[model samples]
Target chain A: MIQLIAYLIIIVLTIIFLIKMIPRKLKKSPPYTCGEPMKFEKPETVFYRTLSNILGLKKLQKLSTGNLNDYLLMIFICFMLLLIVLVMV
Target chain B: MLAPYAVPLLICTAFALPVFKNEKLIKAIAILAIFLSLSFVLSSSIEVFNSGTKVFAVSGFKAPFGIVMVLDKFSSTVASLILFLSLMIAAFSSKLVKERVKEFYTLLLLGIVGSLGIVITGDIFNMFVFTEIMNIATYALIGFTAKKEGLEASFKYLIIGSVSAVLMLLAISLLYSHVGTLNMADIISRIDTNDIYLKTIFIMLILSFCVKIAVFPFYVWKPDVISGSLEPVAAFFIGVMTTTTVYVIIRIFYTILGIYYSTWFSIIAIVTMIVGSFLALLQKDIKRILAYGSISQLGYIFLAFSTGLAFQGMYHLVNNAIIEVLLFLSIGTMLMHKKMMEKISMYAFLLGALSLIGIPPLSAFFSKFFIITGLLEKNLFIYAIISGLISIVTLLYYMKIYFMLKQGEKKIYWPIIILIIAVLLLSFVPVWLQIFKGVEVDLLARNEYVSEVLRP
Candidate 1:
């Protein structure tokens, strides 16, 4: 039972991360599309809002002065952290 | 008899290649060398199957102490396939490569030599050395086009490949420290594999190979590498390189480690299949889709292994390699003949993709059917269902290719037609019908493998 729960947790986390990694084109109502109205009113698409918040997708876009290398560095750090967690856990 | 000559001849020819500067002469030499190598591999494979496993010890030393080459069913089958694919690629390359023909052929042959060495070597360290040789040759080959994307892809591949290699080296060093032997059979006999330390090494080694095979999460480097390299080079890497790498994985897990844990392989296989297929659905470029498609196909092969149907895995491995070569070669020809994939190439691509998507009455369908059956036999219903559903994703992506191709002009290529016929013939052949049952029994008897490798 414990093992099953652990597996379920892993699966949920994986899905979340996969959603985060998906390119903006694949995402529905990406942050830029959720603009003016979202600032004052709650978005009708709860899923998009949650994803945006969890992934910090909007913040990254808003702060987008970074180059390709910086993005690559970010990805590398995330990958290393994931690997470490996988191995140690 | 011919099996022993394959590696030496390839290596010698690779070195001899630099002496010639004329492009035609270089291409001819490369083709000749690969043809001879293929002939040797085929002849030796026949001998191996008929008379049982053949062992070739190097420098007058016996097994467990010196390097020995083993020619068994698995190694011979994979080696023959590699050599045949290399031969085709060599012959077809002349039409594609314009400059540095000598370097290209040399690296290509060196890659062949290294892959063959990995297959046949009994010593684990030699396997690592050969892997590095194969990797170096591949890195150079990927950079051969020297476009911006090609160089960047090659550099990225180099970094990822180096990390994998280091992990493998660390695993080897750990095993050596524990068991005090480099010979696979000797180490298998001496080491206590169940120890946590050994298990750690095993995971490390498996992760290293996972990187090579482009399993999920580690597969990020593959699309760029495939897209940046020449079409035929991409085909060879997808088909032959992965075949050899999976062969080593089997060798290590089943033969050397002597441990079976289907759960881990199954989980990873499932993830790889889903992620690969899903991502493939989003790709627009034909080659990138196929590259991602190869990842999904590998997931099937690994899934078979995870179910403990190694014979099925081997069967699917060969089937997938054939499909990959056919697809990539057709794509290459089409690219070379025109800017867009025309009618004939589209037909060729459709045929390959159909086979890949598990259309009935094709070799790929048989392999996949066998794999699913293996999953069912093992009572892995979830995996069986997952595989069944993944085929839909596979079909969708392939249909995307088909619809895209529908827009292109029609023209026929005879070579592709010949490959189409071969694919059909293989689909209908019952050559494996009688043997696979026996193989299923034999693989479960793991002692058979250990005894065969260890017999003094």
Candidate 2:
């Protein structure tokens, strides 16, 4: 049981550290080649404005990215292995 | 009675390390911990030499019902090697480890604990767990130096290591569904009862080992890690840890799975031998050169294990451990360019490389002689010829490194003088005595290892 506690603590701390270490991702700048705007911007200005209005960073994040609760489960597995060994003890 | 002391003492010492503020005190404790561990391993080896196998159940529970530690000729011998190198590394790296001293020693001891657990435990699941513990410590240790390449190598190692862990776990899960027993001996004794599952398990287990050892195509990550790391711990980690995995493969497959299943395992052995040697020849950097050399060396070890020459394989194991560690310690020092340390590591490499390539009379020569002779006795004349050819090729690489070192720009650190002379003495004395005294190590025919382990 104590071993399980220890393993859990280690997992929690490692996850916290790893997250802090991962560099923040930034959006890509429009291509600098040729003076033409990406995807005919003048022709699609209205559509772009509509899309921008509906699909901001928060909306894009909601659509394109999601959390998996990986940290919680990682801790759970570590605790489980620790529990198994402790029980064997 | 001494079984628990190995793990618990290390644990106690590591846990208590934080309370001690003085670096000198921690170094003393680290050295003390490994020395005491070495003493126990040595004593256990003596006991096993006297008897046959030492089997003890944990907490007084019997085998199959509770966890068991088997101190056979095999495990005891490996343990002794582990302690021998580890004690030396602990003593040598003591004053040198500057980063996170407490954590460093703690992880090192923990890594040894995991290795010991992996060797001693009869449970396969426990082996997986111990391997993970070991991987974590080693991965962290690789990054401990805080160098850019060190971090990169550690990350690469982490991903690959994690995959191996998963593969092993999956293999274990599949194995348990059929065998329903985790005790290695129990599994071994009952293995012949199934046919289809037997082969499947062999493939799984072999993949696990090949992945772990990084043999042939699998051996790429090691060079980057070994060559890049500033920590001497990487030297022992490569030297002893990889050796343990190969030994474990032999013990698990041939000893546990029985010879009927293992007879055909030599193909990969031969392939690893050829490929490892081929890559070993093409390296320019000092460490990478030795890295491939270790791979090729693993080839001979695989040959012995596959041929069922357990004792011979083990003799090779010890020889490989000794020669490589000696060479690396010196070479690692040379890489540091501490004046005489430069000449010393290369000179040690020259003599050690001869031993490694199996020239007459050196320790490794005897090991290769046994394997090749064991091969001829098995009537695998082709393998004997191939092994001989590879040894010649390996010798060329050794000579290449020799010439390079002999020709390199002058560096004058002389602590390496003592080390060089030591390697010279070690290389010359034993072989010279054996030749003059006509001391004979009777060459075992094929299947020599099988009979030795089964003998009494």
Candidate 3:
């Protein structure tokens, strides 16, 4: 319990220090945009879109279009693949 | 004695809740019942850890003939954890849920009862019954908001969940036909591990539960369900519901079937981790991101279990539950108050996200550490490296949420405060309680569980 308390104290102190020391202006700046105002897309959108394109996961994501029939087909295909793999092993 | 009463007490309370028209009274009854149930589970778990396994046969019928509830170190701990999460969610929901208060509490109580039954019961057929009960309650709860999206998500889940239930029942029937018994211990003692028919049965069972836990190819419906439901209900699904399903998988594969490792399951786990993390990166909705995040976390737990690290798997399971619930409830509170742009909520969200990313000195960090070490010990260097990479991916997505957060009014939510404290205190569980040693033993020692259940 003493060790736990010590760890907790360290964590609390670290968080407080970081919060106090960081400049408020820096902390509040909108990420990935210049100081000048312009139309800005969400950083996550840009990052993930590039990553997905690089990885070619766009096709996979398209397959998961929230359509019930597509979901059922995916389930069937996956189950069959798993069944075959396990049975062979 | 008190252990057997926990499920029954909740059932009785659920049935009695509809009689009270007053919402406040109904909420009080529901919370009190869960609190009392949690107490019973805690007392029982303490006794179980000290004295070994305890079995309670229904109506004095012996095991292998009638239903029995086994409170080993593993089940008791899981039951206690489930009840504790339920209690916290119930309390949090007291103010969040507005429509059909009686029905909401009733379904919640029933869901708790089903989750408890799944963990505690020793009969395979009884487990199927409990799974249905749990799934039905969840179906209703998901649609409780009565919105178009919520209704559609609930309907889709109902179709998928019912199909899985049918597969589970069929698997149970096949096992019964092969072994001529429904008791887990009895089947373990009498069955052959290398038989082709038995292997098929095991696969069917695994696939059904894989859907429930939202593994790789089966996880598509989960984000919709989480995004459509109320925040507290979504938290329940992520924290209690999925955790209990994982427990069922562990119990069946490790304790009953006596299969310690599987290559295929490891492959599935790795794919699940990659898919869930990458998908989460693309999501803009907070709940959708969390939904995929949880799927990624479950993959880590599955990887541990499949690699024969039951202790690490169970440790990560507990950590994942606490961290996910903390995130869901805190975010839920922010949405409820229309304070999504608050700095306090952002801080709370960061705490959970960092923990999920396996930052040092946090509870998940230790579990992830144990899992990677265990993987290395088994000479699974490739799996270890993939797990590490997934952590980086986890951090990237969570950082996306961090940067998206904006500053506004800072208001405190008591449930979020309590949960944040819980997440912090979880780091001490392994050192302070020292119960994981006993749970590991209980998981690995198949004969001990078998003998205890079958003892006259």
Query: Which residue runs of candidate 2 sit more than 4 Å off their true CA positions?
Result: A1-89, B1-17, B260-264, B338-346, B404-456
Q: Model 1 over residues A1-87: C-alpha lDDT tens digits?
A: 999999999999999887786554344444445355333223323433454476454542332222334434543454455445435
**All models, DockQ values?**
0.04, 0.01, 0.38
lDDT of 2 by residue, B83-196 (tens): 766766666566457656777777778777777777767678888887787788888888888788778767766776776677678778888887887877667655663476
Q: Enumerate residue pairs that collide in model 2.
A: B309-B449, B310-B449, B330-B345, B338-B413, B339-B412, B339-B413, B340-B412, B340-B413
DockQ top scorer: 3
User: What is model 1's native contact fraction?
Assistant: 0.00
How close is every model to the real structure, measured as TM-score?
0.82, 0.73, 0.91
Looking at candidate 1 chain A, the ten consecutive residues that score lowest on lDDT are A59-68
Compute the DockQ of candidate 1: 0.04
Candidate 3 per-residue lDDT, tens place, B340-386, comes to 64555567778888988999888888889999999999999999999
Clashes of 3: 0
| Model 2, C-alpha of A38: deviation from truth (Å) | 52
Model 1: how far residue B364 lies from native, Å: 0.9
lDDT of each: 0.75, 0.64, 0.85
Instruction: Give DockQ: model 2.
Output: 0.01
